[model samples]
Target: MLLTLIYLIASVTFIVGLKMLSNPATARNGNLIAAGGMTIAILGTIFLYEEDGQKLGNYGWIFGGIAVGTLIGFLAAKKVKMTAMPEMVSLFNGMGGACAMLISIVEFDHLFNKDSGVNFEWTAYPPLSALTSDSFFISALPMGQLLIILLGLIIGTVSFTGSMIAWGKLNGKVKDFSFKNQQVLNILMLVLIVAAASYLLWYCNQVGVKINVLTGMDNTNLPTESFFTNVKIIFYGLFVLSILYGVFFVLPIGGADMPVVISLLNSFTGVAAACGGFLYDNKVMLTGGILVGAAGTLLTILMCKAMNRSLANVLIGSFGGNKATGGGGAGKDQGTYKEISITDTAVVMAYANKVFIVPGYGLAVAQAQHVCHELEKLLESKGVEVKYAIHPVAGRMPGHMNVLLAEADVPYEKLLEMEHANEEFSTTDVVLVLGANDVVNPAAKTDPSSPIYGMPILDVELAKNVIVNKRSMKPGYAGIENDLFFQPKTSMLFGDAKKVLQDLVGEIKNL
Candidate 1:
């Protein structure tokens, strides 16, 4: 009972910590609080619980597993480069998925091995003595929870693989936005797996874990079958199907929708964890899973909203949509394309009184956030006022650019949201547009023909001088041309984001 009180306190801390995380100002503190709660929970599991009460067998294996996992997790967290953040996130999500699925597998195993305390015998089974016996599942407990658990396992497994695929695509492990015949394969596999799971469930109900045989009128028994045996077979089949489903589900999704897909996959992992909690009646698992699931879902929805898209549309994999056909007319015509050499452009920027740095998805792709932050400090040293203009939906996900900047130890107050910075853009002597494209394009507000017309954008064009960095005249993730590139106020600094920034840094110092 005392241990239960300790568990309750730990759970409360987890809840309160999560609540604190909702605000950006408090997020770091919230993470620490949550970590403290988890520590307490782990300690309670290891030391406070009665030996017989805890069902987990073999303490040696448990301790060994914990040690190994902790070592790996710590190493990965410490050593992983910021460029590999997407992959790191996917790996974490996969671990969560595996944990959830393993819990479900244990439950399933218990149900088949009726000797376990986790299993409850069906009252429908025959025997006069059994009829008189009392048990938990004898009447009202909804067995639908088992089905939900299985579904969660399948979905979670798929989500895990999908997220990994997304990470690969982002990192160029696989080519970006390449279409394959993977959609058809996913649909077919989903149907077949669902049918198999359904059949297994139905078989369990009909046989009730008993050895059953078909009998003729003369009572001659045919071949007998055990429900448990079939369940083992079905389980292996489910595992295979899960792997295939994961691969296919992610194969068709393109770069534009990858962030949304990642969020959706995270939600799946949470739902799977919640299902495990429901299966085991573990309150902590339920609470943690529900919180993560809700947060991930909300983030996914918000990303979709920011893109002016629906979740369904993203899943269908349009992937930033097609590039706009025909040239950007009136806007392009209004401005004379002034191409300046890197040396000349750098000199102008170096002498600027004030420079507002605008970062976007490309900056993230190049893993240049830290470098950009360093550049800002260097400029500040030279008496330039450096502020960051942040768009609401900058980078691959909401708060993505902010996270990168924050990771670089940039002061939160130094970042200005769109509305706050838009009014000041005109007065800014130099606007350093770092690897950003569509998010800062004014076409969203001014052109009715633009695909992104309904979306809001940063007002980078209002600046007197704009220095744009790019590798090509190629469109952004949206595949749409940016009018800002052609503007007289803007000069293109074409190269790898990191290299260009480095060169600019050198040039600023030289000046």
Candidate 2:
């Protein structure tokens, strides 16, 4: 009854937390609520062992693992710099995949040894009993269970390795879009695994008997060694196949589509988890898997919408890989840049009736959120209207901009979505673009040849005057030029985002 109630509370919190996340205003509170619920669930699960003789098998080891994991998590969070945030997320996510893979392997070993009729003599401890006779024992060689276990190992390993590759790319350890001669190696691995699987299957078909032994006596029905061999082969084959598939699948994608890839990988993780739940007949695993799968799918859809692309197009075009060549020529013709001093730009902004600010990955790299907040405060004190324009898929992941802004204590109401801000851009007197490109590029709306042509952007070009703070005229992650910089109404202020903003704030004070 207590477990049931605890689960119910956790489930309700998860649902409510998701609902709260729908609005930027409630996102922080929602996250906290969800965290509280998870804490309760973990406590309830740990307490279950106290009631019965049932334990986690190794209590000291379990506690040690927990302690180490917690310390690592805390240190990583505290020590990881903002510039390395994407890599950190990838690393953490990879660890989750690794953990899941280990769990699936442990379960397989338990089932395999039990089916093989393995026995051991006991000394001081109670004599070992036959696990085969245990009611919880899934069929010794249940094909479905075997398949799920195989899938879990394959997907989990692929996710772990692939995510590490992503982290390398983000950290510049690997060049963006570089493909290695790994296809042949992967293919060879696949063939070897398949051959092993075939051999195991043939052996399994030859043996039709089941065996389980306990106390020097046959205990119950179980599959022979051939069955376990076949299961092992399947797992190995699938693991290799998944690794090859993941590498090739992501190899063609460009950095612009990374958000989609992240979401898709997250979905794969959930599916793997669901398979694990089926393997163990564990309800909590099932629930968590379903929730994660559904949420990840939904997030992928939103990311596509943010990019104004279809799921099919994203997959085939390899938008997240190296295949994306920026929509180039159109922006060059329309965008004409004029350099301006921070003082001049600040003067124009100070006298403006309304200002809209667009932030991007550059802001994250510069760690400029705090400075930006100060600028906003300065502008407000002068009675200048200020609003922030945020794209759904801006930065490296979903809600990235929102998270950055929230960290700086930006008011929730000050942040505006693309749609809402679009309607107001034309009425605004100034649009201050900080390290933004693709999200505000006019080429998406006008150039049919653009890879991101149909993507939704913050209509920053609609503002009467535009001020872009950038280190260079370099294209964004999409590798495309932004036409907004060339517009007659646009002016460039070249520098680091934080330095430029600080200078602008100083100038604004003088005005």
Candidate 3:
């Protein structure tokens, strides 16, 4: 009863924490509350959980493993740079999948070895087996348990391998490699996994009668030796096939779609974890898993909608793999982009009635969020209204810019979404784009043939003056040239994001 009460508290805390996370004002506190609840849950499990009236032993090994994992997780979180946070999240999520997979493996071994203190009777029903005078039958395995095991195996393996592939792509360790038949190969592998799992379950049910007869053999202590051998072979085959399916599942997806893929894989891991909870009859684990699974799924759907693409298209089409072929209005005949001096840019921003700052991946790479915030405060002090324009998919992941800006103590109210920022651009005097490319490119609006066409973008061109800070004119991750750079109203401010922001801040202060 005490264990049940503790689990209830943990589950409630998880719900409350999740609710709080939706708003930036309470997010940090929400994280802490959730962590505290998890701590309580762990303590309750270690001290009070029992299996068939037997307590778990080996405290030394258990505590040692926990210590090592905690230390490693702490150090990794501290050392990972903001730019690498996406890959870090993928790596950690993959570890969660691995844990669920291992749990299924251990439970399967325990059941097969008859070490779990539960009695099993495998009985075959009609239509599945025929009755014969000489034939022997045993009760069928528990269908619920078997289903949970299979689900945990399949979903966990897929999450693990898919997340690893995402990590590789984000870190540039793996290139986008796809063939004409890539989608076909992925579909084939998925079908094979389903077929293999079905066959294994069917074979297990059928082999029970043969094993029953073998159990009656004279002078044999364990008569089901062949049963274990055959089942082990089938299990291993299913495991291998599932892993292969996961690899192919994410291989054909392009870089731009990674945020959605990451969320989808996260949902897979959550569902797999829920299977573990069901297998163990743990209520807290079940609740937590359900929450994560539902939230990740919703987030994935939302991200797909934001991109104006279907989830099926994202999985099957290689949208970002090829270099952009359409030039939009970025033809050479367009006037050469003019570079603006820091002093001139600073004077314009200082005198402007309203200023908008747009951030992107380059800002993350240059670790300029803090300095950028400094610039916002400086401009606001001069009675100029400053606001931040954030795109839904600005960085490698969703909410990337929000997190970075929050870390720098930027006010939540000042951060504006794409639509809100666009509405204000026409009234704004100057728009400062900090290391952003594709999100502000006019080609998305003007060129129907452009690769990024149909995607929502910031209308920075609508502002009276636009200044873009970039180290070079290199194309963005989508490999598309930005037509906004060639616009008459746009002026390139060539420098590293951090250096330019610092120089701009200094120049503004001097004025």
Per-model lDDT: 0.74, 0.74, 0.84
Off by over 4 Å in 3: 113-139, 209-227, 321-336, 446-451, 509-511
Give the number of colliding residue pairs in candidate 3.
7
Ranking by TM-score: 3, 1, 2
**Candidate achieving the largest lDDT:** 3
Candidate 1 residue 454 Cα shift, in angstroms, is 2.1
Question: For candidate 1, what is the TM-score?
Answer: 0.84
RMSD (Cα, Å) for all candidates, in order, is 5.4, 6.9, 4.6
lDDT of 3: 0.84
Residue range 122-206, candidate 1, lDDT tens digits: 4453454654323211221135665875776697778777777777887778765434555666678989899988986665554
- Better model by TM-score, 1 or 3? 3
Query: Which window of 10 residues has the lowest lDDT sum in candidate 2?
Result: 118-127
Tens-place lDDT digits, model 3, residues 273-303: 8998899899998999989999999999999
lDDT of 3 at 185: 81
lDDT of 2 by residue, 1-511 (tens): 6776786788778778878977767978998888888888777777662434565467677778889999989999899876567678777767877777777677667656665444211113223473445222222244455556666776677677767766666666755553554445545665665565455444433333323344333334445566566656666566667666666555555666766776777777877777776876655667777787799888888888888888777755443333345455543455358988988899998999899999988898899999999999999999999999998878887677887998899998999988899999999999999888888888788888777888888888789999998899887877777777887889999999999999889889887
